[model samples]
Target: MEIELVNCECCGLKEDCTQDYISEVKAKFDGKWLCGLCSEAVSDEVKRGKKSSFGMDEAVKAHMSFCGKFKSNPAVKVADGMRQMLRRRSGDLSSSSSKKFMRSAST
Candidate 1:
């Protein structure tokens, strides 16, 4: 298995990967190779079926644009990614103090 250095199309992260693995990722993401994290993120979007017309190409493009915005600062990139994840898991954070769950009065 020959190892190749590949850069992620979306997040600009680089990794040493087997040629077979790289080709497999390119096949899945429209000829662009993505790192594990990015591929998983894009895959998640596809699985959600949030947009009827969205597909792998669109998801890759969307993530690429998102990563582009944060490429200058790796710290900010991670922070923003975490924020987005939190929002996705906990609903929108627009109302900071609304409430997550009612306080169970079991005292």
Candidate 2:
């Protein structure tokens, strides 16, 4: 199978994938190619949209719009990722501390 470098429609992330794989991904995303992360985000959006009775096209458009906002600058994207990582780490630390506090209180 031949491999091709494909740019994601949402995040502009480039991935080397086989033509068959690329075709499969495009087929799943309403003919637009998305990277793995964007695809998962879109899939989640579709699930969330189901609760509001929105269709796949609307979900895709919403996700594309969200991604478009952040795709303009690489520095901004990196900073955003760092911010999210820090937030997750802080949350984990707080939860661990709370667990320790509970243990100490029980003892």
Candidate lDDT scores, in order, read: 0.80, 0.84
> Using Cα atoms with residue i matched to residue i, what is each candidate's TM-score against the true structure?
0.65, 0.67
Candidate 1 lDDT over 56-93, as tens digits, reads 88899888887888736343477689999998767656
Please write out the lDDT profile of model 2 over residues 18-48, one tens digit for every residue.
9999999988988999888778888988888
Error of 2 at 65 (Å): 0.6
* Shift in Å, residue 106, candidate 2: 33
lDDT value, residue 36 of candidate 2? 80
Per-structure clash totals for the candidates:
0, 0
lDDT of candidate 1?
Answer: 0.80
For model 2, the stretches where C-alpha displacement exceeds 4 angstroms are: 71-107
Q: List the residue pairs that clash in candidate 1.
A: none
